[model samples]
Each structure stands twice: as structure tokens, then as C-alpha cells.
Target: MIENIHFIAVALLIALGIYTLIFKRNLIKIAMGISILASGINLFLISLGYRAQGIAPIFTNAAIAASEVQAKMVLPAPQALTLTSIVISLAVTALMLSFAIIIYQKTGSLDATKSRRLKG
Candidate 1:
């Protein structure tokens, strides 16, 4: 079970985020849920690139054999993707929160059901 701790954490984070997104009425809560979901995705991506006794992809040592370096070095692609994801999620979260703030200013409420678009 310990071997899959990261997977377990990812599942929990996703579940909580989904629950919040579906059941919460507040716009801020919804934004938090999205942020949590993004965090879980980032964790999953990082975990995917993990290796036991792994080293960075960078190789500064000239004496090490190429085969040994290849065997020990972790893949860089997932880390790069995760970094990009972080930047994107940060922007998305900022946008969501900013929109929420503007909506609250106009409506004086953060409840989604009370928003302009939802009322029929």
C-alpha cells in the first residue's frame, strides 16, 4: 500500500475537488475546487516521472558511463510538462478568482445560483 501512496493521494484530491465543485454553492469554493483539481493533476504528473534512486536528467559528470547515466537519470519530459501545467493553472486560478470577485462586486453575492447567468 505504501508503494502507491502518491496514487492514493491523487485519488483523494480529485474526489474532494469534484465533491466541492458539485456540492458547493459559493464561487470561491468552486475556485478552490478547481485549484485542488489542478494540484492533484500536477502531483500525478510528477509521480509518473519518479524513479527509484533517480538522478536529474542533467549530466555534468564526464567520467560516468553513458549507459549508467541513462539508467539512473529520470525522464525530464514529465517535469517540464508539470511546470507548464503549474503556470497555466496559476493563470486559470487567477482568472477564476478575479471573475468571482467581479461577480461578487456586481451581485453582492458569491453563490452560484444567485449569479446573473443562472437565473432564468
Candidate 2:
């Protein structure tokens, strides 16, 4: 059903990310691949909290109605965690990109093999 589709999507994203990271020689491409992998994991986590017949997690003090009972089925924790992860991932991506830019400026190349800082 829907679960199988989600699994396939997540698996494909992870596979592409791994391929990009391993096959791309450019640092920026590798960073982008890592970001893709992180995003896929985040999506999988959010999907895990989804219920086909559920509703939002809002509540009121009024007497519970049949509709309210039917609407009180969401899991907020996973959504919150995903939001936090997105913010953290943004920061990490910015930092990594900045470092890559610095490396490129210093060495004038995007290829990791051309960087001489590691040479003895």
C-alpha cells in the first residue's frame, strides 16, 4: 500500500545519495549528496508518524465531540523533531559549503585529489 511506496522512495533517495557521494569527485557535490541523504531520513521519520485516518493534535476544553475524537489522532513529536532536524541540517550544510569554498579558494580546484595540504 502507501507504506510500500514510502519505503521505495526512501530507499531510492538513500541509494542515489550514496552513489553521488562515492562517485562524485567534487566536494560540493558530495556535500549535496549528504544533504539529500539527510533529507530522505527526515522524510522517512515524518512518514512514520502519519496515520491514514488520523487528524491534527489540537485540543479544546469544550466537551469532547465525536468529530473531536476522530480528529485527535496525530503524533506531534515526530513533526517537531523533523522541524528541528531541518534547521540543524541547514546550518550544517551552510558550514560545509563555506569550508568547501575556502578550500577551493586556497587551492583553486574542486578536486580533493589536487589538494596538497595532506601531502608529506
Off by over 4 Å in 2: 61-72
Per-residue lDDT over 9-120 for candidate 2, one digit per residue giving the tens place of the 0 to 100 score:
8888888899989998888998999899988888888888888767677665534676667555687899999999999989989998999999989888988767756776
* Clashes within 3 Å, all models in order: 0, 0
* Cα RMSD for predicted model 2: 2.8
How many backbone overlaps does candidate 2 show? 0
The whole-model C-alpha lDDT of candidate 1 against the native structure comes to: 0.92
Clashing pairs in 2: none
| Top model number, TM-score | 1
Query: Which candidate has the top score in lDDT?
Result: 1
TM-score of 1: 0.93
Q: Each model's TM-score, in the order given? A: 0.93, 0.85
Name the runs in model 1 displaced over 4 angstroms: none
lDDT of each: 0.92, 0.84
